[model samples]
Target: MCTNTKENDMDIYEFYSGRSFDAYRELGAHVKKEVTGKKTVVSGVEFVTYAPNALGVNVIGEFNDWNETVMERCYDGSFFKVFVPEARPGMMYKYKIYHRDGSSMEHCDPYGFGMELRPAFASIIRDMDTYRFHDAKWMKNRSVCQGSPLNIYEVHLGSWRTKPVFDEQGNPLTPEEIAESNRVAESWYTYKEIAPMLAEYVKEQGYNYVEFMPLSEHPSDQSWGYQNTGFFSPTSRYGTADDLKEMIDILHQHNIGTILDFVPVHFALDGYGLARYDGTALYEYPSNDVGYSEWGSMNFIHSKGEVRSFLQSAANYWLSEYHFDGLRMDAISRIIYWMGDESRGVNDRAVDFIRNMNQGLKDRHPSIILCAEDSTDFKGTTKETKYGGLGFDYKWDMGWMNDTLNFFRTLPFVRGEHYHDLTFSMMYNYNERYLLPLSHDEVVHGKATIIQKMAGMYEEKFPQAKALYAYMYAHPGKKLNFMGNEIGQFREWDEKREQDWDLLKYPNHDSFHQYMKALNKIYMKEPALSAWDDDPNGFAWILCGKENDVVYIFQREVNEDKVIVVLNLSGLVYKNYHFNYENGDTMKVLINSDWNKFGGSTKDTEKTIKGVNGDFGFDLPAFSGIYLKPVD
Candidate 1:
C-alpha cells in the first residue's frame, strides 16, 4: 500500500491535461516532508507518472529491492502516484508497468531530475534546492542580446579536455603512459573540476558567452548528447545535478553567460526511455510513417496536449533550475516542416506548437533568449507572436554560411562568377534577426575544418582563412564559432577526443591564434563594428563587383565613426587599389591580415594613408584583407 492518500491533489491531473508549465516540479519525483506522528517528521519522495492505458503500475527502486507491487494508484485512472516514506534522495528507481496483455516493462521517469550513468539506467532522486548559487550580480545585469556583442564559443564538454596521466613521483607521465591511459578513454573530469578551466579559457579568448553542445543524459557517447534519454537530468557522465549547477555557478562568477544547445524535436529510441511508456506510445507517435525522425529516433507528437506540456516544462526547468542564459533549439527545421523536408509541406500542428511554446516561455522569462537553427525561408521567425510570428530571438543564417563557405572553396580564377555570394546576404538581412554561425555542423562528417575549406594548398589556406574571418567579423549580425576554428586546427571535430592543443607550438598556428584574439578584442572594443548590427545604416558598400581583381570593400559605421574593410581574393598583388572613401581625410590601418605578424608577406607597405578628394588608394596584398578606420 502507498504511504498516504491525503497528499493527493489535482496538480498532476492538470499537468496531464496540458495546463501546467511547471509540471516538472509537480510530477516525477518530488521530495516532501510529512508529519507522520507527534514529534516525528519523516522526509520522503512522491512518485507520480501518467500511464492512463496501463493495467497497473508500481514504483520500483533500490529502497524496496526492486519490488513490483508495493505502491498503489490514485483515485483517477489517468494518473498513478505513490508516496513512500522510505524513498529518500539519491535512491535509484523506475516504474514497473503492467500492460493489458499480461506483459510488463520498466521505464525511466519522464520527469526524473537525475539518472544513473550509462549501463545503469535507473533514475536517481535528487533534491533540487541543495545547491546555493552565487550569481546574483550576473543575473541582475543580464539582458536579452539585442545590439550587443554576443560572440559564442560552442564547445562539447567531454572533448574540450580530458584527464592527464601522471607518474608516482607527481611528474607528468611519458607518451607511453599517456597512450596506455588513453587507450580505453576512461579518464574524465567532473563538472566541478572542469568549470573554472573552461571559464578561464573562454574569457582569455574574449568570448562573452559559451554555448554547450547539449549536456543532457544520453546512453551513447557518439551521439554527443543529442540523443537524449534524460531531458531533465544532466548527464551523470560528468557528475550529479548539483555538480552541473556548480559548473554554471563558476561560469557565472567569471561573468561568462551559458547557452545550452537544447533538443526538443526527437528523443533516443532506447527501450527503457520514453519510447513505449505504459506499454504504449505515450510520449511519441505510434505509427512509423510519421513517428520516426531523420536520425532514426521517435518523433514527439506535438498535437497531443500532454506532450506539449511535457516538452515546455523540460525547457523551463533548465532556465529556472540551472540558471541557463539562453537556449539554442536544435533541429527546429524539423518542427517547421514534416520530417525536416521542405518538400513535405509545412506541418501545421508542429507550427502551432512552436508558436504556443515560444510565447509561453517568453511570458515567463522575457530576458532569456530563444534561438532557432532553421534553414527554411520561414518568415517572421524572429518576430513576436502577437505580431503573427514564431517569436524567436535569433535565427541561424544557413544560406549565408553555405554561400560564404562555397565562395571561399572556389579558386581565385573562378571566384568572379561567385562574387555575388559575398554580397547576397545583405539583400534579406533585415527580414529576421540572424546569427552568423560557423558551427559544429560544418566541421564534421567529412566536411573538413574551417581552414581546410579554403581553395588552396596546405600553406596557402592560412592567408585566405584570415581574410575570411576578417570579413565575418565586419559583416552584420552576432557571431558563433566552433571550438577549434580559432587555432587553425585542421582536424575535424570528434566527440571522443580533446582538441589539438599542441598545434599552438607551431609558428603559423600560434600566429593565427593571436590574430583571432586581436580580431575578437577589436570586435568587443569597437561599437561601430557591433553596436547597430541589425540596422541597415550600420553597413555600407564602398566597392563591389570588381570581378577582374576580385576585390571588395565595405564600411561598418555607427554614430559617424566608420571602419572600412578590404578583401583581395586573387593571388596576384595590386600595387595600387583605389576606392572611394567617404571622409577619407584621416584613414589609418586598423588591422592588416597581410602584415608579417599574422604569417603574411606584406610588411613594407605604410600603415597610414591619405585620400585626395574622397578617394583613397593602398597596396592591396594578395589573398588577404585589412580593416581601415577613418580617424576623422
Candidate 2:
C-alpha cells in the first residue's frame, strides 16, 4: 500500500466523512476523457473503489487478460484507482483485494454501474450519461403524491411476462446449463420487451404507476431481486441498464410513472457480495447477532458514516440515473427496531440515518416519493423531517391491510364481531399519509392470494372479493394491488411462472376483472374518490357500530362533490335500508358492485334517489358494495 496522495485522498476523506451522497458517480468506474498532451486527448475508463483494510488492490478484467499487474493501487491507502485507455463499455472487470494477512480475494466493484448475470459475478463498465431521455414533459409536470390519485400496480418484472426463449444468453431461466432452450414459459421478458405491454395493461386497468418488485442485481431467482447485490446496476437478467432507461421512457411516454422497490436494510450473503468484503465486516455489523438478518442476509450497519453514504448514494443514484418517479422502500420497520422486533426497543442510530437520508433525498428531489412499508406505529414515519419525523412522503397502511384481510377471512355470520377490523383504520388514518397495499407479501409463502383469502367456497368468494375491492377503492387512502389480484388469481405468486392470464376465460374471473377496471376508472375519474385524500374533510363513516347486518357505509367528500359508499358483507339482502342525504342534492347509483357484469345478483340500476328532508332508501344486495354519487 502507498501513502496518501493529496489529489485522490481529498474526496476520499469526504466519502468516509459521510457527506458525499452522490458518491456513486465519484467512486464508481466512470468513463472520462483525459488529456495526454496539449493537443492529444484519450478516452478511457477510470476505476475507483474503497477498501480501507486491504493491503493492496488491483484491477483485473478482459482488458488486462485477467492480470493483476496492469493496474496498481493509487497513493491513497484507503482508495484504489487505475485508468485503462483500452477499457471500453461491455468489458467485464473485478477488483483483486489483497488483505493484510496475505490473503487475496476477487470482489465485484461496490459502486459499479453494471453487473454480469448470476453464476458469473463481475462488474461491467457502462457509460450512463450518453442515453437521451425524452420524458421532459413527464419530469416537468411530476409532483409529490400528497393529494393525487396513485393507484399502483405492483409487478414482479421477470414473472410479469414470460415469453418463449427468444434470446437464450439474455434470458432469466431456472437451469443455467439446460440443453433445451424452448419450453412452456421458457424465458422471462426483459425490461424493454415488457415495458410497452406493462404500460398498456396498467393504463387499461386505470393504474397511473407501476411499482416493480426490485430491479437490482441478485443471484437467486427466488429472491425476486429483494436480496440485492448490485444496488446501482439494474439486473442483467432484464437486459442492460440502458434498456431499463428506455423502458421507463416508454412508460413515461404513456403517462405512467415507475417506482422501484428498494431494499436498504440488508443485502444477500453471497461471497461476491458485500459480505466480508476486504476480509472484514465493513458494510455489516461485526457480530452476527446484529449483522445477520431474518432472511439469511447481512443487515447493513447504518451507524457507520461510509455505510450510510453508500446506502444513501445508492438510493439517490436510482432516482437520478434511471429517472424513477419514486422508491417503495421494503421492510423499513427493521430499520426502526432491532431485527424489526419492537420488543427489542428502537434502534436510534438506524432511525436517525433513515430521517437524514429521507430529508437529504427530499432536498435533492422535491417531487419524488419516498414511501416506507413500515408496520410499526412509529410516530412521524411520514411526517416531514423538520417536525422531528422520519420524513416519508407516504407510509404503507399495514394495519388497514391486516384488519381488512382478517375481517374478510371470517365467515359472514361471524363478521359482525370483527366489523371493528374494518373501521379500525380511521382511528389512525390522519396520523400519516397512508397507502392501502395488498402487496406481494400478502399473496405468497402459504398466505393465500387475496381472492383465496376470502371466506367460503369457490363460488361464494368472487362476489365477496368484488365487494372487497369496492371497499378498498372507496376507502380514503391511495391504493396498491398485487399483479394478479385484479383478475382474482387463486395460486400463490411464483417467481418462475407468469400471472394466470388464461383465467380471464372464466366468466367469474373475467367479470371480477372488469369490475376492478370499472372501479379503478371511477376512482381515478371521481374527484370525491381521489382528490383531497390526506384531508380529514374528504372522508367520513356514515354507517358503523352495527352488529347484526355487518353493513357499512362511508362518505368521500371533495369540495361540494360527495360520494356515498355502501357495503354489505353478509349473504342476505336487506330491503329498504334507510339513510339520509342532503336536500336538493340529486343522488344516483354510480357503481353497483353486485351487478351481473361483476358476477353478482344485482342489476345496473341507475335509480335516482329523490331525497325529501335529507332522507333516502335503497335495497342493498348480499355480499355487495356500491357507490352513489350526487349528480346534477
**Per-residue CA lDDT of candidate 2, range 5-40, in tens?**
455444666566666678887677888665666853
After superposition, the stretches of candidate 2 with alpha carbons farther than 4 Å from their true spots are 1-10, 34-42, 70-76, 165-186, 605-607
What CA root-mean-square deviation does each model show from the true structure? 2.8, 3.3
* CA-RMSD of model 2: 3.3
Please give the range of 10 consecutive residues that has the lowest summed lDDT in model 1.
1-10
For model 2, what is the error of residue 491's alpha carbon versus the real structure, in angstroms, after optimal superposition? 0.8
Misplaced by over 4 Å in model 1 are 1-17, 34-42, 165-185, 604-607
Per-residue lDDT tens digits for candidate 1, residues 257-333, read 99999988999999888888888898899899988887878899988888988988988999999999989999998
Report every candidate's CA lDDT.
0.86, 0.86
Candidate 2: C-alpha lDDT: 0.86
